[model samples]
Target chain A: MSPTNATPPSERTRVRRVAQRGRYDRETLHAIVDAAYVCHVAFADEHGVHCIPTACWREGDHLYIHGSNGSRMLKLATHGAQICVTITHLDGLVLARSAFHHSMNYRSAVIYGVFDIVEGAAKAAALDTFVEKIAPGRSREVRPGDINELAATTVLRVAIDEAAAKIRTGGPRDDEADMTREVWAGVLPLAMRPRTPIIDAAPSGTPDYVRQWHEIASANAAV
Target chain B: MSPTNATPPSERTRVRRVAQRGRYDRETLHAIVDAAYVCHVAFADEHGVHCIPTACWREGDHLYIHGSNGSRMLKLATHGAQICVTITHLDGLVLARSAFHHSMNYRSAVIYGVFDIVEGAAKAAALDTFVEKIAPGRSREVRPGDINELAATTVLRVAIDEAAAKIRTGGPRDDEADMTREVWAGVLPLAMRPRTPIIDAAPSGTPDYVRQWHEIASANAAV
Candidate 1:
């Protein structure tokens, strides 16, 4: 499938609480997924519901995840078990004049669907996409996965068609009565900023991605 | 109950994959929870599995969450529904020499349990603890939740008894064969850093927490 033109492609995807903060567009969903390095996946079995965090990335209209072939999650998901994948980026801490109105600024996306295994040549390409996401040009530099290694990994993707994004930004919205309270109210803005890269035993010159990582974080932090 | 001296207290909480990375101690679980502002809660309903992100805080041996009384998750949880709460802190991107060995450095905690409601005085106190967590001494400066506001909210807590923490740190563990590959290998560390505080229309002087926000980020980033 492609980016959802209409929000809430399914009944379960509708946002009920704080409906004003909900976004059902593809752009919002993709942005949330792309910005995250990890996502929490929710699924159920006889033992009950489980929420596990795993590395994730987005390519076009699908969100991709990979793990060992023996992974409980991948094995269960391969069987077409219904699952929910969520990515949340906590942007800041919203402080209000009243404790009741305090909230956090965050961008969160929730996708509901079943994962389809990516096999054959697409699997290798998908793995490259993930590496490229982390460091451009480095995929070619690094030794590619061997046939045995590739066989041991399972890559799965879920369509972003049934997804909803909920975002909260800016300052706190205090009640009219509480606005006059003598309190320090504002947003303690936060971002996942990069520290100075800790380069390991590189066999050659540093990659462009590593060199620019701190720069990118500084640029984002300034915003 | 105190921190578990023995790990894998229950059958389900056991970490099956990469068992060496798992820690069942309470200290590990508490640190993960304390470091997170939000948690992804997985619960099953007629609509299927749902992973929702909500503001979370740790109060001693329990993880606390609150929402409007009409919240579906709160209502369902109030009824003793078994659920899973997960908190993950992505520390860095681990770029390995081989595509197959690529991984992420993170600290995560998964807790399986049923939520119990906090009522009366304990509920109010629990909310205060959350406020204090966000801003050390600001709880006194802000107007506390009124009776009406308190009545409209529901606070739920789950014991940290059945929990496991998985953490992976340092550089990537590349395969012996790939170790000689001429690739820039290392960690691009990332952290939730505080940007400059965005002060709203405050009626008084800046608080200590707001003042120290950026400094704290700098200190953490240096580490």
Candidate 2:
């Protein structure tokens, strides 16, 4: 996003705890949301709060999530209820000389808003966005959802009204006394990647987009 | 746990949607929670619902999470606020002939209960558990938290009364009509691994447990 289009902090979006780690920029939030494959959506009622993990994609300032018509989460969210969508990518494990200093290096984002259920032509376009965002150029290559399929699905999008991104990096910050100890302390890095593309019996070999993404992921994993 | 230690479903734990994916067994829930590095915790209040991602560990029927004493979620949860803790591990990406059939293979668990703040000796033991759990033997080798360090942290646990685990595996389940299309369809396996370990400048050589876990993670990625 342009500098002028950055997200501003709201009362609810402000990071009250560990305030130093919080980021209030649209670019940071967008990058985190776009790179993540799934998010945990939370909604509540008199019964209790429910946090459901589901796939999502970011397009512009909006985040789109879809589910079957029969999904309890989809049904509850479509009624214009408030929701919290959170995505966290664990980067590594922080090892410290003292137990209390142990932590993890990570990047996370939380978005707050009510979802608007897409319908008719808009829903179709949003579903297309989900597939295309998941894998570049694949949406144009594959068959789109049929009428029955579209009717049975529910797509919802929440515009970025309030959001915050938090990140932690670098090696462990051990205490001065503990740092002198002989125990080793540093980050044990963690990463996510596609293992390999399993081609179906179908005629097409692996598509370039898929293969290219896999290669890039594999290369990153190697370092 | 013994055969008699099964986790029976409570009123809220019963899987109302996609019932087939739900598992009420303690063994299943334990395995899913143990493998996950983080969980998205959901809670509601007069203001609204919030989802925060944080580190967690499961031991027996109890799940423990710790945060800075000033954390909003930790404070609310310590005061008997109802909370939902959900952990999800994305295993693979399912590519189907049609967009509607696209999905991901994952293992997830959500536990609902009130958190009890751990204190004194029990808090010390729990912090040890957190360390041992994250990297098994590292706790024994390192010094335990001192007075100030322990006082600065808040550890909380929720004994499981109602919990559910949902998992999806295997290849894409495309419709019979669409399966005949000349489209590649299957699962693109995804996994987590520790990148080359960054040995702290102070080292007794990388511990066997850490090295062994990295080797196993790398071996799995190779296949």
Q: Against the true two-chain complex, what DockQ does each candidate achieve?
A: 0.71, 0.65
DockQ leader = 1
TM-score, per-candidate, Cα-based: 0.96, 0.94
Top candidate, metric lDDT: 1
The regions of model 2 sitting more than 4 angstroms off are A1-4, A213-220, B1-5, B213-220
How well docked is model 1, in DockQ terms? 0.71
Model 1: how far residue B88 lies from native, Å: 0.1
Candidate 1: residue A207 Cα off by (Å)? 0.8
Worst 10 residues of 1 chain A by lDDT: A1-10
Instruction: Write down the lDDT of every candidate, Cα atoms only.
Output: 0.89, 0.83
Residue lDDT tens for model 1, B1-223: 3444655557778888998788889888898999999999999999999999999999889999999998888999999999999999999998889888888899999999999999999999999999999999878988899999999999999999899998999998998988888888899999888888888966788788987885665453544
What is the C-alpha local distance difference test score of candidate 1?
0.89
Write down the RMSD of all candidates, one decimal each: 2.6, 2.5
**lDDT digits (tens) for residues A1-223 of candidate 2:** 2354557788888987767788878888898998888999999976799899999998788998999999888998998899999999999998888787788999999999999988999899888888877677778867898899899999999986698889898888887878777777777888877777666645767777567656755564535
lDDT of 1 by residue, A1-223 (tens): 3445756547887778888888888888888999988999999998999999999999999999999999999999999999999999999999999999999999999999999999999999999999999998878998899999999999999999899998899899999988788888889988888877878777798878988886765453545
lDDT of 2 at B80: 91
